[model samples]
Target chain A: MTVQATLKAPGEKLIRIRLELEAHEVREAAISGDFFIHPEESVSILEEALLGRPGTQEKLLKRLQDTVELGGLELVGISAESIASCALKAYENRKGPGKA
Target chain B: MEEWRLIIDRPGRGTYNMAVDLSILNSLARQACPPTLRLYSWYPPAITIGYFQRLEEEVRINKCRAAGVDVIRRVTGGGAVFHDRELTYSVFIPLSHSLALPSIRESYGLLCSPIVECLKSYGLNAHFSPVNDVLTGGAKLSGSAQTRRNGVLLQHGTLLVGADTELMFSLLNVSKEKSVAAAEGSPEGRVTSLSALLGELVLDGEFQTDLSMRLANAFAEGLGCVFVQAELSEAERREALEIEEGLFKREEWNRDRSIRPAFGAAGD
Candidate 1:
């Protein structure tokens, strides 16, 4: 099932996350926002990196952090933690056969 | 005094305008051109969403099409902007320049100083707000966006001469409550135009020319540089055309924000 969550983290631009979750795993993910990220293409890379990752906060946050570090991405008004939190929020909001 | 190119462009289509800016940035990055300041307007009027924004979430495409308005995506990241009844200015500088500070907030403040000065000349008490906004009396009068790549910085912003809040709201994805508020005068009661502030219509060739000159002078004084009026070189024009065709005009780039050209993407 697909779920979406929007966040306006303090001192950051609005971030909207959409995730397709199945069995508590992220099957697909798309992130969009007004936040600034250097090497802007890294945004697409980060989105692509989310696929098949376990939709837990810790796993998602670790994956995002590793991706940012590996890519040397500079986020001006957003952060990996914020994005991971947003993705987790989407997962928590998911509606599916097994999900509450 | 240091010298810069001052390009006063005639109103052009959205794609062409964006193409010219990117072309200039690319040239400067390659050390093929001097620093530049370009002042321009939109032909059909347009909406430019920031790089990170999703078009489907930010703009009402069918509404814009019916109104003969163009929708383009900017290389810089920021909130979406409506380019109607506004003069847009862009400045390109190498990172080694004194004005291009290492800190993003500091750089924005320095680059926006000219805009604040220009508004102050018209008797408005304007000030630069952090991250890329110019404000007067707590209402936003101008907003800017920036991108740095290959040790070059390009910052562009808009100065509103007039506004059609209802039309703007129709083209953007905003709530009915905000649209109604905008109809009363300004968008969300937070935007004010030069015409509204000056208590007269500021739309005319003479006024535009005067405003452009004033902005150029302000930039020259603020940056400690002199500007020589010039047209885009043949090479730059050709590059702009290339970008217009290869990047700006492409559906994959504009609507989907995919398929970026090497020179068009932003990075440190």
Candidate 2:
């Protein structure tokens, strides 16, 4: 089953995450939010970067950091750390049955 | 005291207004000009989306076009703003300027202090609300956005003088929560204009000129700058026109390249 989690942080901005975790690989991730970023197009690039990456804390953080560094994305109210945490939080909160 | 060029521009088309701000910012970046502040208005009124905001999501395009309201994109990051019934100002300065703090948030607080003082001068109890807005009577009176490039920073803001709240909200794609709040009371109802506060709409010409002079004086005192009135130079005008015709007026720069804005729970 696809898992979805929505998190609102710092009061004003909200980020919702939906993805599938298969054999330790994050797949089909879709992240959307109401936040401002300089070079606004960078969000699409960040969304694309999350695909097929490991959903673990270290891997997620590295992925997010790398995305910002590569794209020079400046998130005004949202942080990559928040995004990473949401991913992990959603994964843990997944409604699907655990793999055998 | 530092010398700052001050331009009290005639009302202009939205495209030209944005282009002029960018032109001055670029000139400052190149050290081709000194720091400056421009106070201006929109002709035909406009809705400008933040750099990261989606065009279709932020505005009601057909409604905007039908009303002849031009919709443009800003280089600065902020929520969508309806630019009618407002006094707009843009300040351009080098990043190394004492007022331009290295931290964006700190810079916003320091820069917005002048605007707060401007409102306070009018006998309104105004104060900075942090991150980039000025509030009066516990509601927002002005909001500013910032963008930095090439060692220069440009901060632009809109100060509400009056508005057609119904028309303004009709032009925006307000979120469900804000919509609900609006049903009870317009989410934007929190936004109060000087005219609204004063109980009658002031004559546009008189109000504009008066507000401009007061803000100019407040800014001069706050920033320790001597305001020298000046018009746009040939080079700056040429650049602004180029941007006006080529970029701000183009779909690729204005519409097709926008991101959707997220909605909050009647806030932000």
Candidate 3:
């Protein structure tokens, strides 16, 4: 797996993880930040959904946003646009289709 | 009046079982129905790890592949558990339900009290250990995990009516030094069985039935609500199938994405 991160602001970052997966499952994941989300238990929910998943850039970003949103994470400085852009770049880098 | 629902589902594969559990949880999140208790089993024994555990660390993929055991990760958190010949139970309760206990520890205690009581009835001293485990003389006979979201709480556990501990140790990659060190760090105790404890006090089938009854009564008393026997709603079944097809049964979701150790052999 290859991962990339683009920081949008303090307390917010967009991470794009390119997984070498043949199917649509999330096998593993890791999230680190300095913030608190309500109910503390929501982290477990996010972990369950993201781990062991196979997804394209758009789908993974959407799922991650949905998961965090469902768990009531406020999308402060990190916007969906940033996440998508970061994911697309990461995917391109992983593919190495452009720059030699 | 307390109504108890009994469901004895046909043995299904492990992924299917997990799909059903997730479906039930999703429905509960949607406020679809009353809290439910389900009793089920697996066809071929499988190994399920926690949601957060590293797949490489917790499972021996080559061993599992060679031995024909299915490996999957669960939606709940805890250590890895081997599901074989064991009675698995799950409970999904809406968070607002009066019966829905507050806090993880309280809920685990409430859900597992009956099992402990049933064990005592059979002359074994079983108690709920902290952080969600049932122990008898420090040996874990049952282990459970829980996940709460969208006003629904799903808790599931395995009762070791019987198991192959040696095979469990081997197939779970417990041979590695890190695994051994982790095991050593854990509270040391051997696994125990109901048959071993009963000493002929109860027949196998009767033991299962009696335990179920005790758990039902405990839930009724704990939550002050009735449990109606129910089957999977068509919507739930549909959701489960979709999730299974899209996630559980997929290879990328089941493997890969592991941050393999920087040192050691390539495969390790």
Candidate 4:
């Protein structure tokens, strides 16, 4: 199932996440928004790093932080915590068998 | 005072404009060109979307094509902007320069000070809104975005001389009703043009040239630099053509946000 989430934190720009999930794992992810990230390519790197990860906020946050440190990315108006929160929201909002 | 090259460019298409800026940035990074301040305008007009923005979600392509407006993606990150009735300025400063601030947020404020100064000179009480915007009278008057490469930083911004709220809203994928509200200066609308603030419908070539001159003076004074009138070198022009072909003018690059540049990540 594919689910999406949009988040606009108080001091950050809007971030929209599209998560493709199967069996409680992230198959693919696409992140887009008006936020600024230096070297710009770090965005694609972030998305690629999310592939095959567990669809949980804590794990996603760790992965995102690792990617940021390894990539030396400077994110303005957005952060790893916000991104993970949005991604997890998408996973929880998935309207598949997990729904009540 | 430090000397910086100043180029007053005539109106140009969006692809050529973006290509020229990127080419100049590369030149500065290579230490092949002096720090430069370029003032320019768009000829047929265009909308430039931010680097991370989804093009289809932000723009109406068919409507733009029907209206003869060009759309391109900027390397800098910000909201999409409609380029018309505005004076655009780009400043390229190598990190070696004494004026280059060490942090991105501070650099935006430093680079944008001149715009606020110019607006203040016009008696508008304009101020710099951090993270890249200038506001006056509770509405935005100018917005800027930045990209760094190698050891150089490039910041470009637009100062609106007039506003075409109707046509701008039509081309953008935004609520139609906001256009009327914008013209009326409703609280929901946050854009204000020079003409609107000054209570004059000033859209003449002479006015543009005057505005450009005033801005150039303001930048020189604010940055503690002297402007030496100059033009792009032949080699730089050639590089711009290459960039136009390789990046800015490509349909795939314009439409797809994920298309990486062949030259690799900037600043790497």
Task: Calculate model 3's interface RMSD in Å.
Answer: 10.2
| TM-scores for the candidates | 0.89, 0.82, 0.66, 0.91
- The candidate maximizing DockQ is 4
Candidate 4 deviant stretches above 4 angstroms: A53-55, A96-100, B175-189, B257-259, B262-268
Error of 1 at A73 (Å): 2.5
Best by TM-score: 4
DockQ of each: 0.45, 0.26, 0.04, 0.50
Error of 2 at B62 (Å): 1.2
Global CA lDDT computed for model 4: 0.83
What value of lDDT does candidate 1 attain over all alpha carbons?
0.84
Runs off by more than 4 Å, candidate 2: A1-8, A14-45, A53-59, A66-74, A85-100, B177-189, B258-268
Tens digits of per-residue lDDT, candidate 2, B151-190, equal 7788999999888889998898775544454356522225
Clash tally for model 4:
0
Better of 3 and 4 by TM-score: 4
Candidate 1 docking quality: incorrect, acceptable, medium or high: acceptable
Candidates, ranked, TM-score = 4, 1, 2, 3
TM-score of chain A of each: 0.84, 0.77, 0.45, 0.86
Q: What are the clashing pairs of model 1? A: none
Candidate 2 collision pairs: A34-B262, B54-B259
Residue-wise C-alpha lDDT for candidate 2, range A7-33, written one tens digit per residue? 655534556677766765666776654
Model 1: residue B17 alpha-carbon error in angstroms: 0.4
TM-score of chain A of 1: 0.84
Q: What docking tier does model 4 reach?
A: medium
